[model samples]
Target: MLKFIALRLLQGMLVLLGIYAVTFVLVAATPGSPFSSERAIAPEILAQIEAFYGYDKPLGERFITSLGNVLQGEFGPSAVYANRTVTQIIAESFPVSIKLGSISLLLALVLGVPAGILAAVKRNTWLDYLPMSVSMAGICLPTFVMGPLLALVFGLILKMLPVAGWYGPEYVVLPATTLGLYYAAYFARLTRGGMLEMLNQDWVRTARAKGVPEHTIIWKHCLKGGLIPAITFLGPALAGIISGSFVVETIFQIPGLGQWFVRAALNRDDFLVLGLTVLFAAMIVIMNLLVDIVQVALNPRLKYD
Candidate 1:
């Protein structure tokens, strides 16, 4: 187990390094300087700006410094928006993304698991049909569309939830729930399929023959095994959502990193965009690592030794 974990960590480091190199090269090679979009300043001021940030250094020196900082966990500074270090940007904005992603994941699991179980148990009955239909709706619609619709119904018409702003609890409901609904459909279908497959296996029949309490057999014996494949999706799904759902955040007027990313991209804030990409890629790597560990932990019989 220790060896397995160490290997995974090493692999994660290699992947992150590759991602950093690719992002750096891509951003550097893209047309112009980070300061290209800024209004004209005197050559002296420009030179000063470049020198202060080490942009005055040769490309190789800059690359080495950037890579060194990355090794030290420094993501660099935003040249345009916020005028803050990458760490500062993450410190300020990451909590919002984390909160949204966490809540949405929780929401997916809470609603998805039960609905899937019921659908599997009920099979083709009306009880099964309703949730499947709802899942269809969820899959068909997107966060951006649902976010505004939810805001309208829950915010405008009802005046119960706030339509915009991230002041408090009310602000999060529409956006998080909207984002969550999309994934809920995915998880629900996964669970339903996995459960159904498990139910058909000879072990399920044996459990029935032995007259194990139906609930116990279903929940205890069936569920754990059934959920393994579903667990595999969690890492990438969470990372993708956290990376910034620009449309959802935009429509909801939420001050998340996603919103920041979009505006930064539009303004050609290369440094800001690059910083966001690195942050997101790191998140993806970490989430995948966590999922791998969790998946192994959940199934002790699976051998890493």
Candidate 2:
């Protein structure tokens, strides 16, 4: 187990390094200078600014320096934001994203698992058709479209929730629901399919023949194996949510890492963009590793090498 964990960690580090290098090169190659603007500054002043930020250094030297600083846990200063470090910005913004994502994920599991299970158990009945239909509608509606419709219904028409801003607990409900519902559709489908397959397996027949309670057979014998697909989807889904959903953040006017990442790209704030990219890459890698560990734990038949 120790060896498996170490191997996964090593692979994750390599993947993160590759992501950093790709993001660095792409951002470096992009056209606009971080200092460029609609208004012109004096050449000497611009030169002074460039020198201060080490933009005057050779490209290779800058990349090497940035990589070294990253290894030492220094993301350096934000070029556009006066007197702010990349680390500081991420620190301030990420908690909100985490809160939003956690609630959204909880909502997905709560709604999705039961719906999927019901659909699987009742195959051809109304119980099956109703939830599956809703799940299908969810899968069809993208978040961009869904966010506005939800905002219009709940926030504008019904006036039950705030349409924008992240002020209090109520502020999160719409955005979290919007994000959660979208993924819940996918989870519902995956779970239903997995449960159907598990229910048809020989063990299920054996349990039924031995007079095991139907609910116990379904919950204990089937659900454990059936949930594997949903668990697999969860790793990256959680990472993406926790990193911040850019569209949802923008639509709701939430101040999170997603908003900052968009601003950094548009304004050509290379350090901030690079920092966010690396952070997201790290999250994805770590979450996937955790998911793999959980999968192995749940299924002893699976071996780690």
Candidate 3:
């Protein structure tokens, strides 16, 4: 297990390095300097500013310097934000993203798993059809559309929730729900499919023949195996939730890393964009590693190579 973990970690590190290299190249290839938008500055003044930030250096030199700084845990100064570093911006905003992602994940599991189990158990009935229909609709509707609709009904019409702004606990509900429901639809379908397959397995028939209580068979024997697909989906899903919150955060006016990432891209804040990219890439790698570990734990028959 230790060897497996260490091997996975090494692979994850290599993946992160590849992501960083790709992102760095893209950012470098993008037209326009970080100071391109500045109004009517003297050429000498522009040159001085660029020199001060080491932007006057060649792209290769800058990349090497940035790589060295990152290795030492420094993300360098933000091009757009005065006196602020990329590290500082990430530190301030990541907690909000984490909070939103965590809640969304929990909501997806809580709502989706049960709905799926019920649908599978009650297959060919209204109980199955209704949830399946809803899940289909959810899969069709993108978060951009769904978010405003939710805000409109719950926040505007019912006055049950705020339309925007992430101030307190209540503010979390709308955004989290919007994000969660989208993934929940996918989860529900995956779960139902997994459960149905597990239910048809020979072991399940044997359990039934041995007179195991239906509920115990379903909950204990089937659920463990049924959940494998959902568990596997969680790794990439979690990464998506964290990085994809840009839309949700924007719609709801939440101050999270996703929002920062959006601004950094628009503003051409090279370091900030690269930092966020690396952070998100690292998160995805870590989550995937955890998923592999969990998969092994849940299925002793599986062995790590």
Candidate 4:
């Protein structure tokens, strides 16, 4: 297990390096300087400012310097934000993103797991069909569309929940639902498939033959094996939720890392972009590693390797 973890960490480091290299290359290749704005500066002044930020260096030199800084956990100054470093911005905003993402993840699990179990148990019945149909619709609708549609109904028409801002729990409902529903659809499908497979196994038949209660058979005998697919999907689903929050954040006016991320991309704030990318990629790698470890632990048949 230690060897497996060490190997995975090494691979994760390599992935982070590759991501940094690719993002740096793309940022360098983009046409505009981060300093470009509606207001023009004198050429000499611009040159001095560029030199101050080491932007005057060759692309290769800048990349090397940036990578070295990143290795030391220094993300450098933000080009667009004037007085802030990338690290400062992330520290301030990431909690908001995490809060939103965690709630969305929890909501997805709550809505999806029971529905999936029911669908699997009640196959060919309305109890199966209704939830599955709704989940299918959820899958079809992307967050960008879903966010506003939800806002329109719950916020505008019904006038129950607040449409925008990140002030309180009331503000959380729309965005979290919009982000969660998509992943819930996937979870529901995965859970149903896995449960169906488990229900058809020989042990399940044997349990039924032994006069075990249906609920007991499902909740105890089948649940662990049945949830394997959903567990496997959890890591990627979480990563997707974080990335997808960028759009949802915009639609809902949330003051989160997603807001900074989107602005960094649009403004070509090189340091900010690279920092956020590294942060996101690291999160994904760690989540996947944890998921793999959990999956192996849960199933005795699965070796760590």
Candidate 5:
């Protein structure tokens, strides 16, 4: 187990390095200075500014320096934001993203699991048909579309929830719901399929022959193995959520990492963009590792190595 974990961590480091290198190359190749603005600075002043940030160095040297700083967990300064480091900005904003993502994930699990269980158990009945249809619709609708329609119904016409801003608990409902519902649809479908497969297994037939109560057979015997597909999706879903959903954050005016992530790209804040990319890449690696570990634990037939 320790060796497996160690191997995965090593692989994760390599993946992060590759992601960092690729992002750096892309950012460097892109035209326009991070300092570009409406007003032009004097040549000498611009030279001094570039030299101050070590941008005056050759590309290879700059890349080496940036990589060293990244290894030490520093992301340098933000070019667009006058007095902030990339690290500082992430520190302030990542928690907001985490909060939103956590709630959204919780909501997905709460709503999706039951819906899936019902759909599977009910089979061809309306109970099965209704939720499957809704799940299909949810899958088809992108968050950009769902966010506004929800805002219109619940925020504008109903006036029950705020359309934008990251203020109180009330502010989170629409964004979280918008994000959660999409994944919930996926979870419902995955769970239903897994459960259906589990239900048809030989053990299930054996349990039924022994006259075990139907509900107990479904809940106790089937549920654990049946949830494997949902669990598989959970890792990437959690990582993506925690990294922040750019569209949802934008629509809802949330001051999360996603906001900075988008701005960093457009404004050519190189360090900030690199910092967020590395952070996101690292999260993906870690989450996938965790999912594998969890999957192994759940399935006794599976070996860690």
Candidate 6:
């Protein structure tokens, strides 16, 4: 098990390194810098800007310097953010993103699990229809579209929730729902499938024959078996949310990591972009690794080591 975990960890590291390389290359290939979008500058001012950012250096040299900086936990500063370092940008933005993602994850689990269980238990009835229909609707609506629609209905028409701004729990409701519903659909589908399969297994049949209570058989035996695959999906799902809800946060103007991430990528803020990219990629990779370990531990009969 340790060997398996070690191997997976190495693989995860390599994958994140590749993701970092791709993002860096794309950022380097962009036509202009964030400074290019600014007003015309005198030669001395240009020199100052270039020198401050090491933009005047050769590309190879800059890349090497940037790599060294990354090793030292220096993500560099944002030219657009008035001398704020990428680390500082993330420091402020991460909390909001984390809060949003955590809320969304809770919502996804709360909605998805019960819906999926009911859908499976009452397979031929309206309960099944309801969850499937909801899942379809959720998958059909991207967060970009859903975020605004929610704002319109819940915020504008009803005026129950705030239309914009990240104030507190109420402020989180729409964005969390908008981000979570799609993932809920995904989890629901996965859970339904896993449950259907587990329900048919020989062990489940034996449990029923031995007069085990239906609830115990379903909850204790079937649920754990059903959860293994869902657990895998849940890990990455969580990582994605943790990185930030770009559309939901943006639509609501939450001023989270997603806001800076989008702006940095669009504005060609190299250091900021690279930093955010690496942060996101690293999170995803780490989550996946944790999923692998958990999957192995839960199914002890399976042997990878």
TM-scores, in order shown? Answer: 0.93, 0.97, 0.97, 0.96, 0.96, 0.92
- Per candidate, the number of residue pairs that clash is 0, 0, 0, 0, 0, 0
Q: For model 3, how does the per-residue alpha-carbon lDDT over 54-81 read when each residue is reduced to its tens digit?
A: 8889988988998999999998999989
Alpha carbon deviation, residue 83, candidate 1 (Å): 3.8
Q: Write the per-residue lDDT of candidate 6 for residues 39-142, one digit (tens) a residue.
A: 68787987888898998888779888888888788888886776689999999999889889988998898888778877877787998998988998897888
Candidate 4: worst-modelled 10 consecutive residues by lDDT: 235-244
lDDT digits (tens) for residues 1-305 of candidate 2: 89999999999899989999999899889997999999999999999999998899998899999999999999989999969999999999989888888899999999998889989999989988999999999989988999999999999999999999999999999999999998888788889998999999998999999999999998899998899999999998898777658889999999988899999999899999999999998988888988898899888899898
Candidate achieving the largest lDDT = 5
The models' CA-based lDDT, in order, is 0.80, 0.91, 0.92, 0.92, 0.93, 0.84
- The lDDT, on a scale of 0 to 1, for candidate 6 is 0.84
> Per lDDT, what order, best first?
5, 3, 4, 2, 6, 1
In angstroms, give how far residue 259 of model 4 lies from its true place.
1.8
Q: Give the clashing pairs for model 2.
A: none
Instruction: Write down the lDDT that model 2 would get.
Output: 0.91
For 174-206, candidate 4 gives per-residue lDDT tens digits of 999998888888889889999999898999989
Q: Would you give me the overall lDDT of model 1?
A: 0.80
Give the local distance difference test score of model 3. Answer: 0.92
Question: Between prediction 3 and prediction 6, which has the larger lDDT?
Answer: 3
Runs with alpha carbons beyond 4 Å of true place in candidate 3: none
